[model samples]
Target chain A: MDTAVLAGEIMQRSGAETYRVEDTMSHIMRKSHATRIETSAFTTMLLVSLQEEGRQPLTVVRRVHKRGMNLDRIVHVNEISRKLCGDSLSLEEAYAELKAIEQESQKLYRPITYQAATLLTVIGFAVFFGGTWLDIIGGGIVGAVLVGINLLGKKLRFNNVFQDISASIGIALMGIILKQYVFWNMNLETVIISGIMPLVPGIAITNAVRDTLMGDYLSGAARILEAFMQAAAVAVGIGVGIVIASALIGEKVLL
Target chain B: MILKIIGVFIAIVAYSVIIETPRRFLWLSGLVSAVGGAVFVVCNEAWRMDMVLASFWSALGIALLSHIFARAFRAPVTLFLVAGILPTVPGAGMYRTVYYLILGDASMSSFYLTQTLEVAGVIALAIFLMDSVSRIFLKRDVGTQPWTKERNMDKKQEEK
Candidate 1:
């Protein structure tokens, strides 16, 4: 029962779909010779129960906070669960592995590497959008600004929607400055769009679709609404940035 | 076109890193995204298809390939599908919708709003169709796998 809840918590925190978490938890509990097992997962909570013939029913509820995209952790947990269910791993070993995965302190990439990757991603998006050399360079610069904003937000403990809005505002301001002052002919659309790609709710929307198809309507609706809210936040931030820039620059520079 | 596809692959790989995908599967995710981007490029640029249609085709291609790769690699399907489908997601449409709204053009805003919903809907449809199709095959494959055979027998015994 403990292992099942731990596994479910890690999977949910790592942003696995609701059904996957439920399925994994129930599967793990079944291995304990329980006559009945029940698992339920929502976007932010997990409940699992196990009942044996002559023993009291055991139940666990874990509230998950601070969700992020960490496919590496999800893959690790999936592998451990698979091995455990396949009878290749002992329960103690499986519990140990789950604990390690939950408390992993090692960073996957260096700070500099993460910043550079963000730069590269935005630059690549600019190129994919058919940007010229100037646009790519401008996009990279805006991407760097975004990275800086994110780091600062982390230090300040900004909430998720606030983080996204601040990042989009930074992208918009940087794009305008680059186009107006640094690169005279750079395409603002390319730079702004590419820079905002990192802040998009693509993964969230996709996950919502997957969850809904898996017959988990509660989390699915929550996620879909979450995605739209994030998108609106980004859009509103950009709009504010544009208005601020125009007022400061003494012209309506953008529509 | 080649340049754009390469760019999409690079972006996808970098995005996967940002999301902390396992190192071993980074290239696989990149490959999947590039293929989907290629399809969108061909359908949109070469054939002048509508953006909604292009995105649907791209998402369908990504979903199919991600399912195949997930089965082949024994990894969760979302590990590949989430990042791979990034390029086709309707971020631009959503942006445009709000952009026009802020500009006080209610008509254009509504138009893009509908377009964004359509694109999102088609993408969901594509994923749903592929998921159902893949599950049928996945069931047969898992039933035959030796590792799951024991579990299957246990289930059968429980039923009896």
Candidate 2:
């Protein structure tokens, strides 16, 4: 039961779907000779109960306060549970594996590699949107600035909304500066859009759709609200950036 | 078109890294995302389909591929589905909605907002259909086993 709850907690906190969480917990519980297993998962909590024959019901509840997207952790937990269910792993081994996964999820990526990935994402989006070579260069520079802001925001532990807004404002300002002083014909719209791609809530929206479709109405609604808030933050960020850029440049770029 | 596909692959790979997808499955996720993007481009640009409908088809294709990969790799579908569907998501529409709203153009803002919601709804429907169909097939396959039925009966009794 403890192992089952631990697995469920890791999956839930890592932003796996609620149904998947329940399924994994119950599967793990079944391996313990439990006659009955009941598992319920929410966006913020996990409840699991295992009843063996004639004893008492063992219940465990874990409250998940912070949720982030870490699919690597989810896949790890899934694999561990599958092995446990197949009788390949002992209970203690499963526990140790889950603990390791928890730690791995907390580890941060290398700063340089993360920054490079951000740059590539921005440039890729710019090219995908039909931006020219200059747009790609402008987008890369803007993306680098955004990455710096994100690293700073992480160190400062800023709220997600504030982080997105500030990064976007930085991107817009950098785009304007590039257009005026560096590249005369750089497309600010493409640069700004590509820079903001990392901030968009694509995963949240997709998860919301899946949750709602799977009949997990509560989590589905919660995820939808989460996506909406994220999108609103990005929009507010870019809007503020655009306004500030226009004010500083003394030109109406909106028209 | 080739550049767009390559761009989609690169962008999805970067996104997979950001989300911390398992290293083994990163390339598969990127490939699935590239397929979705190609389908979207074909549907929206070549066929001139409406944006919402195009998003629906693209999302549908991604979900199907996700299921296939999930079964093949013994991993969860979300491993591929989340990153793969990024290309068809209404990120641009959401931005445009807010952009128009900031510009004080209510009509355009509402227009983009509706488009975003419609695309979201269609994506939901596509995933829902895939989930239901897969469940049905899985049930049929498992139903042929006597022990599986016995387990289901046991579960029903326990629930009662």
Candidate 3:
């Protein structure tokens, strides 16, 4: 029971889909002598109950917070559970493995590498959208600035919506500044779109679709709403930046 | 077109880093994403498909590839599926939806909003179909269903 709950907790906090979380937990619990196992996972909480013929029913509930994408951890937990079910690992060994996975999931990438990845992602998007060399350079500069803001925002523990809004505003403002003063022929649209790619909720939207199809209606709807709010925040930020820039320059920029 | 494929590969790899996908599988995931992007571009430009239809085809390819990779690597399908589907996600439409909304152009906003939802719907259908078909054919190996033979063995063991 404990092992199942632990696996579910790790998977939930790591942003596994709700059905997958329930499935994993149930799979782990089935290895025990429990005759009946029931597990249900929501976006914010997980519940597991197991019953044996002669023993008291066991129920565990875990509240999931701080959901983030960590596919590595999900894969690790899946492997550990599979091993446990296959009888290759004892209960203690499985528990220990889960603990190790929890720790490893908390490990952060090097700050420099993370920043560089952000820059590269923007450049890639600019090129994918058929931007010119100048646009790629401009997008990279904007991406670097956005990465700095994100790092700072994480340090300050800013609200997610607020952080997205501010970062997007920075992106749009930089794009306009580069177009007006730095690079005469740079395409502001390509640069701004590329810079904001990292802020988009692509994962959330994909997960939401999967969840709904898997019959987890509650989680699916919640994730869709979350994606909408995030996109709106970014749009508002870009609009604000464009409005401000246009006011300063006394020329309307059609966005 | 080749540059776009390369860009898709780099973008997916960079995203894998952010999502902390296992390092060993990063290259494979990038390849899957690039293939999806290539399909999307072909459907959109070469075949002159609608945006929503193009997204559907791309998502179908990605989900199918993810399932294949999952079976080969003995890993969860979500690892590759989430990253590979990035290119087909309606981020641009979402941006346009909100952009027109803020600009007070309700007609444009509504158009993009519908486009976004339609794209999301088609992507969902593609994934659903892949999952259902895989579950039917690979019922014994996939281990997604609870009533598989392995679970029955546990029940039998408990009975004894």
Number of the top-ranking candidate, with lDDT as the measure: 1
Pick out the ten consecutive residues of candidate 3 chain B with the lowest summed lDDT: B142-151
lDDT of candidate 1 over A104-187, digit per residue (tens): 877687778778888888988998889999999998899889989989998999999999888888888888887888898998
The DockQ leader among the candidates is: 1
For candidate 1 chain A, the 10 contiguous residues with the lowest summed lDDT are: A246-255
| Candidate 1 C-alpha error for residue B77, in Å | 0.3
Q: Give the alpha carbon lDDT tens digit for every residue of A1-255 in model 3.
A: 888999999999888988888888888887777779999999899999989998999888888888888887888888888778778999999999898787763454676777888888888888887889999999889998899899889999999999999998898888888898889799877788888888887788778877887889999999989887887788888888877877787565554
DockQ of 2: 0.53
- TM-score of predicted chain B versus true chain B for each candidate: 0.89, 0.86, 0.90
| Native-interface RMSD of candidate 2 | 2.7
lDDT of 1 at A82: 78
True contacts kept of 3: 0.64
Best by TM-score: 1
| Order of the predicted models by lDDT, top scorer first | 1, 3, 2
**On residues B29-130, what C-alpha lDDT tens digit does candidate 2 reach at each position?**
999989999999899899999999999999889988887777677677889998898877777787788678777899999999999889877887888887
Q: After superposing candidate 3, which stretches have Cα over 4 Å from the reference?
A: A105-108, B99-106, B140-159
Output the lDDT of residue A196, model 3: 84
Tens digit per residue, CA lDDT, model 2, A1-255? 878888999899888988788878877777677777899998988888888899988888788998888898888887788777657999999999888777763444665777788888888888877788999899889989988999999999998789888887788778877887899888777777888888888888878877887779999999999988888788888778778877887756665
